[model samples]
Target: MKRALTDLAVFGGPAAFLRPLLVGMPTVGDRARFLARLEWALDNEWLTNGGPLATELEGRIADITGVRYCVATCNATAALQLVLRASGVTGQVIMPSLTFAATPHSASWIGLEPVFCDVDPVTGCLDPARVAELITPATGAIVGVHLWGRAAPVTELEKLAAEHGVKLFFDAAHAFGCTSGDRPIGGFGNAEVFSFHATKTVMSFEGGAVTTDDGELAEQLVALRSFGIDRNKSVTAVGMNAKMSECSAAMGLTSLDAFGETRERNRENHALYRSELSGVPGIEVLPFDESERNNHQYVILLTDHAVTGLHRDRLQTLLQAEKVFPQLYFSPPCHLMPAYRTDPPLRLEHTERLSERVLALPTGPSVSFEDIRRVSSIIRLAAERGEQIDAMWAGAVPA
Candidate 1:
């Protein structure tokens, strides 16, 4: 533990950790099983194009998500694009600005304008009231993001979409294996997309899937993921190459097999963080719902600079100096990015405020309980001496 500001690595003292603790370290499970599946794929010489392994993965995901059809893709962005294309929605899509850039990118890439909306201050998900306000005759769809494994306002978004005669879908990238009430996340909206990227709780060695109950839409998606070729070997529609390989599917299967254990470890880590940072003033470890099934993928913290006397960025720098690398997720948010920036400048009060305060700490299978404790100790110490640290930081900065 750091005794004084000078004892910190930033002050030329030894780092608390020799190696950097990272957020979103890949969770590799049962290596032997993954290898065996990989070997099978090799022996069969079936690498891609909806091979048997990919088919099995789709089935398993469908079963888990409680959706009728699961169309696996090369990545989540492609899955989103495919779903948007298949839905035939046009003009503009309303989405929270507090999401990964891919959410807006997917829509914009397919010729639809992405209108940024503010999120709910508490949940950090798309505000249904804001969505209602954004609806217009040209509003093609409403895309809700399940931020940090928490479900979006699904019921309300659904109602709004239905009332407005617009389509609805979710970017369930952070919400794989999560639930809202008893229903799984992937089963919500017209269709939902799950990201199995290396950073996610469940991974397919870089893959994603779109889950939906609409048979015709599913059929269209299946064809679209390929070269728009149908079962009859006829070109049905314009499409892109977005099929998940057998190797990725094998990894996906292994990830699913270990999901239970991973979820448990993540849950334990979250609990430990909450306990370790319990009474730290102006420091809040975001809470997950106990009633709903959650992947517990993120260990997020919200810092109140006024109360803590240290800004979130300064706290982040202090932690990083100790070799703990937390992420400022969705900072500069999608709306603020150069590609999406409006001429007049868009102001999303909630998103802007939350983006400055939110920080994602290290968790997942890679992080241990002891690591959480140490990280929390650094935070507690910093908060305890926040003013001093702030003064030190300010002095260190070159005028």
Candidate 2:
């Protein structure tokens, strides 16, 4: 609908929509069911410290993920930290820089040094070849992240980890209800951590879980989450208070009940985006494997400045002015963040390049089909008029 520069909201014209279309909006399940569960938790008066609801949630997660054991935590960070510690790994941990800061932060917080690795440019997941190149006697473990709800190079990473004799795990924050081949994500490696944060498709308001088939490791995690107190109620090992509350578990159950419906909606939105953006120069919608089960929670885009004549940041700004807000998921990647920056500075070519180009558009239950159409139209308009917009930006002074 926007015909020219003068018609764009960024150029002093009216916005395309009355309200902002935002990315990562929380998906609310059946309101009545959620309220009933909340009321039950309150009536029971068991809020935290491994209550009935928390225990039930853990069992459900284990069942859903096809893992023998599941330990729910206050958040994914805590789950990661606990899993890394309980896996009995020491020294350096290798992980991709193209991820949320929490991935490395968890390792670093537990006194392990995080070694940054580059990712596969197309998949946006850890490159096993890079991991092989980085492995040393000092490397304690290898962590792979499932980006955009797509499975990481699980088979290859498993092979590398086995050959090197190091522990392997996954940061499956974006991969709940997703699959790696015939298997579920949580069953991979020594363990996998999933986030149930509100933003996730299957949310618990604010919670996370660690899944594993290792009984001993599961016991250790159980003890670790509750300050290392064993059945006899005596301190055994150094631990942190990272238990999920009953309220969060109740919400989690409700969310799980609505998973199928939410996933369908997400799938529809993703399909609409792909169809609408097809053949639009310089804009690519990331694809998920059709054969495997996926949550389809994120609608990712890769902007090619060379073709579009506008970089990803400028395109994002243009969209935002029209009251459509997309997200730069991991622009300043983990290795580039202040807390995790390397001494001599690391140069991960693929990681750096992908970080700059990747953008997450609005999707999920909150976004309607019409919303996707409007957002897609805005992108198409920007791409079509990229040269003129680039020139206008070049001539304009910095604000």
Candidate 3:
């Protein structure tokens, strides 16, 4: 066993082996396509602020997401802020702390108190029951995050919001190609924000959009994204410059052309991970059964320290030494961040536990099935010989 372990440490030359993916890379031919579209933009001389390409991208997104209205923005964070501001969300907004900091920051940007709520242990999305408990007289809305392309309880959350006369919104940064049953993710709640950041399932380099069925809300969002200018050039509302540029729109359209292929790759990668990692002791592969469509992000939960004899961080360190890089998405929840810390803090039990245990393994179209098998083997062997792996990692480091 010791001899076999040593072989893994030196099996492949560090520089020669393909480095594990830490971010999403644009699909091949995206550059040429983007450049081709840019040529048209240069010919037309419409650079930004609702140019033709941007308008076309907006329409395409609306059509794809099955929503009546879609407004492109500079980024997901800005898209979120625009939705909240345009919806007249004031006072307190109940949201999950188990998300990117931008979720809470968007609320703060609109001068709303982000009351942190707990999430479901299995799904890592805002627990609808916990959200109900957190809502109060001051609560103006609920911001549920579709964490890791998993659908939150959209129907239940919408019902709750409707019953309470509060709006329901989603920070659907991970849900571009995801769906709830047959209905797509963006066609839910008051408005759902989809991120096109480079790391997401589909990307426009750096862009986002808000999907809604309400025409009035959509109009307000369009105005808010620009400097409050309507079609009549009337400065009717307070706004900012959050328009998606012609270049970004061009990239988005190009990326959209390849999303069908990307979605299939994501599904294949997820299946590979589950097939390889399932039945490994102490490792819990969260149920991927809820969503009919998933933009795969490989999140493995190290749920049992006693069974595995190693915590999540220790396993991460060992994997790093093995040239397998896994990320702790939302390691420190929003409430724990320096900017959002409060007096005595909020008790988010699930958020803290999930943050510590969750490890987002390298995934996406670029990652291979062999890569999944390798990562799984590392975890399986580490669980079998925890102390030995730790010793090996320690010895490899220069004193």
What RMSD, rounded to one decimal, does every model reach?
2.8, 2.9, 3.4
How far is 260's C-alpha from truth in model 2 (Å)?
A: 0.4
Estimate the TM-score of every prediction: 0.96, 0.95, 0.91
Q: How would you encode candidate 1's per-residue C-alpha lDDT over 326-392 as one tens digit per residue? A: 9997798988889988888899999999999999999988888778988998899888878878877
Q: lDDT per residue, candidate 2, 1-399, as tens digits? A: 224433444544687535788887887789899899889999999999999999999999999899999999999999999999988889999999988889998999999999999999889899999999999999999999999999999999999999989999999999999999999899999999999999999899999999999999999998999999877788899989999999899989999999999999999999999999999989999988999999999999999999999889988988878888899978998888888777888999999999999899999888989889888988998898788788767654233
lDDT, candidate 3, 1-399, per-residue tens = 233333455334343455755545565336788899999999999999899998998898888789999999989999999999999989999999989999989999879999999999888898989889977889999999988888899989999999899999999898887788798889899999999887766677899999999999999998889889887899999999999999888888888888888778867877777777789888876657753777665455454677777778878776776677787878889988889878888779989988988887777777788877887777777777765555664564332
Whole-model Cα lDDT per candidate?
A: 0.91, 0.91, 0.82
- Candidate with top TM-score is 1
- Residue 243 C-alpha lDDT in model 1: 100
* Candidate 2 residue pairs in clash (backbone atoms < 3 Å): none
| Candidate 3 accuracy as lDDT | 0.82
Arrange candidates, best lDDT first: 1, 2, 3
Please tell me which predicted candidate would have the highest lDDT against the true structure: 1
Badly placed stretches (over 4 Å) of model 3 are 1-17, 298-303, 390-399
